[model samples]
Target: MIKKLAIDDLRPGMEVVQMSSSLWEHLPNLYTQPGPIKSEAHLKLMREQGYQHAFVEVEVPGEPLEKRLDAILADRMKDAPIKERVPFDKEIEVADRAYKSAMNHAHRLINDAKMGRKVDFEGTVETVDGIVNSAVRNPDTLLCLSKLAQYDDYTYGHCINVSAIAVVFGEFLGLSRDELTRLGVAGMMHDLGKTAVPERIINKRARLSSAEFEEIKRHPQYGYDILKRQGDVPEDVLEAVRDHHEKFNGKGYPANRHRSDTSALARIISLADVYDALTSDRSYKDAILPNKALAIMYGMRDQAFDPLEVQLFIKCLGIFPSGSLVKLSTGFYGVVYESNPNLPLMPKIKIILDQDLRPIPSELVDLAARQAVGDENLEILECADPTDYRINLKPYLTRTR
Candidate 1:
């Protein structure tokens, strides 16, 4: 039933199989592989953009798209042997500097947007590139810094962290250096549309009313429009801003798009954005521990995120993600210092409290080397909240070994 039809003949509910058949030569990336036209709004966008016609699949439905999406996810989730080229202890200092520079750049992007100054959409190249280099060398160092440095400036902090987390995850996915850098830039710019929202709404400490919620949902489109006007923003970055909240089930905001309509980078950033938001402190709610956050996200798989993406994200960050505190099966308390990607459960731990649960000088121990060292085998029994133990992890995470 696939047939070429003039754009006027197409209507809501028709499935656009492909643009390659005719017209749509310069369509946006998201429209390249159009799905069911969900609304008149979608048709409006298509018609306004001069889409002359589309190859629509009429009446006949099949499982091919679903099977294709599964295959794409399978290819992406292949594990790469990502080694720490530079030791965490040695790279922490360098990562700290890069983290700071990126934070400053995030602030600059916001300030320029608010002040009506011309933003250098291309300027993010160097800022995110710095993070890409550090994360590739030792991913844990940047991740550790992101967790420990939860600043009062939650918006900017969030932007930089999402970028950093995305870079770390991109590296684990074995993306090329260029792709990682662009993903970083996308993360940094993902929330730029919030600048158009009122400060009161963005920082409100209470639940947003239904009216306010609707306004907030406009942020993705707002961000996309803002960047589109800037003229040089990459398509990947624009897609991330506009589609990061989109769910696999087509219930998410801005476009109600499913996984098939979204770019892979947007899907990846969506995971990073939610992970950081779940684990980082915000004015509206206390932050959940990393392990608990991962568990919650894992529970939401298929409903909100891709199941394979969640599984691999957990593998990349580890069960006991870096910079989170945990209690060992040995009855001692420690901070997870770095993830062993191959062995997710057995990470490098730094014991900060004695078995008695009393404060002690920190000792670094590799869980993977337990048998060789002749020490008692240890496993993380549970994740502990930092508030519960009154621990500040910054000093422990940054100290050079």
Candidate 2:
């Protein structure tokens, strides 16, 4: 049986089935590959590397690794903060203005970097401040708005989205106001190195050749160099820009630093960066829905992402985040207006179409309450693509709750 055992409990001759967490991937000197535990030295090394548990093949009876990990993740989700739900109407207005301002600043920063000109640090700070303040007031508002991806000017929109997401995630983690601002700035500039890459490579629609891929990977270092030359950027912000692509397993590009060596801000921005990139529509591929994106990320935990951060993000957004279109067992279609982390499967939805698929006046429905009242038919059936249903999600996304 495969069982999760504390590093201290590991004994000589016990076979290591696999590393429970991908965080150990970078330390080849400690664990070259999963195999029999040699001695107490191995256990001590793992502890020094910050590993608390490992999956081992033992004669002792136990549950599967997957089931154990799922239980641990569920328990962690419970610890996530449950804030009072603010009315979307009050938050959306501030979010809209903050989003536009951040987008405008991002565009200018990218253009300036491309032209080899110095970035306007003060202006960048102001843009990030607006985003931080808005997130502090009502994270769901900006978070919901950030999901409306635009394809034409993806770079600007993506930066703004990442910044907004990073701030919200940081706030959810109980970061101080100053820390939130720094995280927002880091997210805004995380991809600044892409400006130095040729436009042809940046806009390529086909699969990139090996050489092209290597060239693209250099952006992190290029971004670091560019920012360092400017002389005023904070070290944490620079670290995030340089190492945002670094994975938990130390397999990421540029420096290939392990999770232990990477800064917290870089780790947070990395998750936000991948989330936005996967969910946003691009010329190369159609956008995946938010829930699908989250699932994909969940599978990458301990490998491409920190396991805790991945779970926290899922808790923050729930299974179906705001702006997702879902069908109900009652034969109605609605857009998710907000999530109830405690009841991820049953979020607050805005019903826009009736059973026959005809347009109807929008109405708010709390599936959690419906389920509590014994309305079995009110459960969410599945998430539906807005395009497939001929639904314009933009209207519902912008409408006040």
Candidate 3:
């Protein structure tokens, strides 16, 4: 059987069946195929490359590896603090309203920009205000709802998602209310330049030729131009739209401005922008799981993004962010319901399957709780793909609190 094993428990005899996720694209030299563990040196190299777990073939097991991992997790979670969460139903209600409002505003803004009409700055502020309120009330709700990536328009959905994410991250950073509003506006309008690009180029399913790629890269400047013409837009908002694609190491596009040249708002929006794009399903490629996206972003720290900002982003989202599908130590499948930043690894989960892999009535589980019914030793074994099990998480996730 394919079992998920922690890096520390790996032995030379075991065969690696799969990587925890397809992150090798970011680290080209990292080995990703199924292979026999060569030596402790190999394990060391994998750890150095940021791999924490892998799926391996196990033949000589005393107890199931899942149970063993769960026991370890439960032990570690004994002292984890249990914080009360916003009721799921209430959060879903708020998220639904915010998402619809953002989507409507994004569609209008994009269409208006395409027609050379000035964007409604007051309308943008009002939309962002609602997003900021939802984020400050309970960031996880909108964040979790954002994971429902079955949208008709990628651009609109992406802008809304990025805006919600930026607001949450801004709040986490202790930005003033005014600052959060600006960050939200920046995120909502960061991709406005894409509207100026040809529809064919924007939705192309294949790699772009050099000339086409260059045209695509002009989006930051294009977005800046569009927003700047509005006249009343904030300077910080314009800078954020223009510099969101710039890298911290001076390697990013357009002006190639580096580090201190980029404003703090732009840096924050940049992380959110890339993160939402990576996790959202697109016409060209499948979306990576949230945990995997975070890992890839972590690997890109100091290269594509600011290291401290990346770390803070991960901290803000927690280890297993909302919408992650995980297999519990008790041999059940569940969706991450909420994250406890203080106890990231032990966030609350909503159990959907029982140990036998049979469908069961959903139940909320808090891994940080001192005592859980039926399975006191419950713990997450590893992340699982909802597609693999043909599970539809939308109903469960969007249900009323």
Please list the residue runs of candidate 3 whose C-alpha ends up more than 4 Å from where it truly belongs after superposition: 1-85, 355-358, 371-376
* lDDT sort, best first: 1, 2, 3
Q: Pairs clashing in candidate 2?
A: 22-302
Best by TM-score: 1
* lDDT tens per residue, model 3, 126-148: 67888888777777877787886
Question: Cα miss at 362, model 3 (Å)?
Answer: 1.5
> Which ranges in model 1 have alpha carbons more than 4 Å from their true place?
1-84, 356-358, 372-376
lDDT of 1 by residue, 112-157 (tens): 8777665655456667878988988899987888899857598889
Off by over 4 Å in 2: 1-76, 149-151
Candidates 1 and 3 compared by lDDT, better number:
1
lDDT by residue (tens digit), candidate 2, 1-401: 24446676778888776443344465444342578888888777777877766555556235422234445445556655567645776777777888887877888899989999887654676678888877877787777787864435888888888888889887877665666777888899888999889899989888899999999999998999998887657677788899999999999988789988887778889889999999887777888988999999999999999888798888887798887888888889998887777788988889988887787888888888888999867878889887776767767667653
- What is the Cα root-mean-square deviation between model 1 and the actual structure? 12.7
Query: Which window of 10 residues has the lowest lDDT sum in candidate 3?
Result: 64-73
Which residue pairs collide, candidate 1? none
